[model samples]
Target chain A: MIAELFAGVSTRARVLLVLLAVVMLAAPLVLDRYLVSVLILVCLAAYTGQAWNILLGFAGLLSLGHALYLGLAAYISAGLYVHFGIGPWLGVFPAVAVCVAVAALLGWLAFRFRIEGVYFALLTIAFAEVARIGFDHIGFTGGAGGFFLPVRSEDQGQWWNLRSGPTFFYYLALLLAAGAFLLCAVLRRSRLGHRWLAVREDPEAAQALGIHINRARMSALLLSAGMTGIAGVFQAFYANNLFPSQIFDISRSIDLILAPIIGGVGTLFGPILGAFVLAPLGEVLISITGAIGLNAPGTKALVFGLFLMAIIAGVPTGLWPRLASLLRLRSVGR
Target chain B: MTLSLYLEVLLQGILTGLVYGLMALGLSVIFGVVRVVNFAHGEFAVLAMYAAFVLFTALHVDPILAAIPVAALFFVIGWLLQRFVVQPFIVRPQHDQFILLVGLAIVLVNALLMIFGPDSRHTNLSYSYDSWFIGPIIVDKVRAYAAAAAVVVSAALFAFFRFTLLGTAIRACADNLTGAAVVGLDVKKLYALTFGLGLACAGAAGAIMVALTDVTPMLAPSFTLLAFTIVIVGGLGSMAGALLGGLLIGVVEALASILVEPSMKSMVSFALLVGVLAFRPQGLVGKPA
Candidate 1:
């Protein structure tokens, strides 16, 4: 069934997949552990951004509060492990469920009140901030002290268990990143994706055309939240810690969005390409500047902002669309 | 704490809210006229604090005296930013200007961070620490002075908009860009001047901030959030809303601190924001939505 589905995918997507496979296979050998860690971070960010792209980019429902799901998932998984002896794999589903529920609640409230555009964005942010503060105050989540996953055994690999070495996690992250890209690619070409784009272009027109905007948006929200939850699970296992201040922080959400947004929002490979290139470069910038005796404050964020601005100013169509045009490759729709 | 202590905190919060309102007034002015949210508005205040610190340390100048030149310098910077950076994208996609301003904010903050390390700088002005006693209540003199300065600046700004030709032009530009352009109101100049005015308000706010709290690059980010919350609560582009909203937040924050953990004071303002948004999005004293 999957093979037949793969067969239907275009040549461009196939080429991109092969390229990603090549990079995945070659990364650990070519890159240093630090660089690989940065790559891992990028993958994590890209995955989150891709997840966000489903709701915000594709569905035209902007959510500035996606970090809430990410953080909540991380905390849930980490908290489960810390208290009960349940490993991350078994705990992942619950995390996703919790995040989806929360996302649904937000979507319900937003749709009920008909909060659209900037107001919706602000409300999402407010909700996330509320969750952040709530989590910060709650003692079960370690309040402000943060929750940590114990590192067990430094051997070859523990695939069944989550706490593996960076090399092990790197491959794991690569697999997940590939999964995120595939999820987006699959979603973008589906019937739902068409409805989403229609609604995004014109909500009233989409409604007139028999597309239910709320239903489409809510579905997008759930999928987006679920994907972000999965990424959070990956992040918790990979990092071996979850801090409310760090994970649920507004800055983290912003960081996650910057890559996909600057790379090319709503595109399938944008997050992958964006995270793969930008994440490592940003880490390098920070480390290099630190080495050169210049105190850089949020250099990554600054760079991301500038990159976003430059993209908006110069390449409004985004890198992938421009790349597709240059390479004479054609997508099915456009 | 005790009831009296609680009451005292509430009183202090009301005073602090007044200052917040003043800061929001600056943000409101620019947002009102230009319809562009200056993400770097808080940085103007930060820069002012830094400038004040420099003057106080180097030349032994009073902080207030230093603020005048600081505000003037910032006015020019703000005007230039609007003219060069912001004007090009005013008619483009809405998100473009937002992204540009966000980028500019990052650049400004990072540049400031590079110039001045992350350490908080205190402008140890001699009379800044003095306090006035009102019966049983005590008010920090610097805070009172800062609050008073905010009131004066806000009043003057209100008057400027109400009485001056340029002010009316700026208001006109704010109301309808195309219409103002049609009326030959120098829309571009008005936008730049409005931006300058916003920064000038921030500059004054910064001088007051130095007198009350220590100056640091990180300080502006929190103030940005506070100011944004105030602006939203006060009404998106209402000067009066900004004033009332700031004071409201300051009081809520102070009271929340007394009731709960001091660190959670900000959380209180955030809570109020959410509540207001859910029930009354336009704010308490705002015009029709």
Candidate 2:
């Protein structure tokens, strides 16, 4: 079946995928620790990008404050670690459950109340801001003071604990990225995915065609929240701290959305390509400004802003899809 | 606490609410005419505050006295933004417009930060700390002045929209864009004017805020959220609704600060936003569709 799947794909696509996979696999080996750390960030961005893609691209839900999930999961996992000594892996289970439960509840409330479009997006933001303020006041999470995960190890090889070094996280994020991509591919071909696209195009028309719009949107939110919970777990372990202000920030959500949007809103490869390009571009801008000895404090943010505006203004459809058309290759997304 | 203390806080809440009302009204008007949320709404406030700050230090003028010029400047800025960056995306999916505003917000906020370093600054005069004691209440003079200014501005705005031809045309566009266009209204120019008027309101609010609170480049995001919450509480595009919503939010926030941690006081507005959105999307003054 895997061979059969490949047989139908064009030679150019197959070759491109092979080349991309090889680069992803080999990147950590050749790069230094600092560069490998950046690669890890790219992978993390890709994983979250795919998770976000399922909601915005597939289901037409434009959640402006997606960092709610990431922050919630991080606090849950990190709080459990800081106070109870529970490992992050163990903490992820409850974190995922919390995210799914909250997502389902929100979806039910929204759909039942007939809240859609910009109203729905505003509700999501309200929820995130509420969570941010709530977390900041809670004593167990240390309030605004912050909760720090213990990094007791001096040596660099604690794989199970997830505190070996940047290298361990580098591979972990790569695996998560690969898993997320494959999962997105599988879901894209599934019945739910098809229903999602139908709903995205026209909710009323899809509803008339016997598709359940509520269930479709609900599942997408749940799945996206679940995947984001996993990334949050990784982030808690990787960063070794959880500050509600930093984690649950509106800007953090913006960063998550930028990947799929800048690369391609509705394409599979768009997010991956966007993640690959945007992270490095941010770093390059920072380095270049530093090398030039400019005292510009917001160089990265300024650049990111310009890049997002340029993408929206220049190619609202996304780069990969446009590039595919230009190259006469098979389109990469559903 | 005594009833007198309660009265004092209540008076303070009403005053603060009036300024918040100004912020909310700006957002309400912009949405009413332009049909898109300006994510950079709060940045306009920050801009006005900075403008006030500069005039006070450079020309030895009262920040309140300088507010008019700032509002005018912001009006022009808003007009240009509508003409270029925002106007193109207005016809696309509303989601695209939201995205456009998000990018615009990032650019505005970061650019401001680059221009004005991240430190918080404040203006102090001999009268800054002085307050009026009316019966049981103690009102800071600057805050009182800001609230009084808010009332005057809201009145002026009410008249502008209710009596002016452009205001009626704006209302027509908000009510039905196609119909307004059919009626020969210049919807495009009206949109620019409406956007300018909205930013001008924010500028007025920002200048008032400079007298009462410290100025910071980061002030806009929170104010934007505050304005959004007030707008949600009041109802979309309803000027009267913005006034009532802003006052209500202000009172609730003040009461929350007294009852809970001041740091947690912001949650009151957000919680109200969610509650209002879930149960009453039409808002306090909004008629049910």
Give i-RMS (Å) per prediction.
Answer: 2.4, 1.5
Evaluate all candidate structures by whole-model CA lDDT and list the values in order: 0.77, 0.85
DockQ of each: 0.43, 0.66
What TM-score fits each model? 0.92, 0.97
What digit string (tens of lDDT, one per residue) describes model 1 on residues A75-182?
Answer: 898888788877789889999999999888878867765667655766677767777778888898788787778776773366776766787788877777778777
Candidate 1 to truth, TM: 0.92
What is the per-residue lDDT of model 1 for residues B7-119, given as tens digits with 9 covering 90 to 100?
Answer: 66777777777777877888888878887777667766787788888888889877766667877887898899889878888787555565566566666666677788789
lDDT of 2 by residue, A1-334 (tens): 3564464567888787888889878887888988998899899999999999999999999888789999989889888877887877789999989988888877887887678777788778878888888888888888888888877856347676677777778888999998888888777777888999999999999999999889899999999988998998899889988888888888898999888998898788788889988988888888898899754447787778888888888888878787677666675443
* Model 2 chain A worst lDDT window (10 residues): A1-10
The model with the greatest lDDT is 2
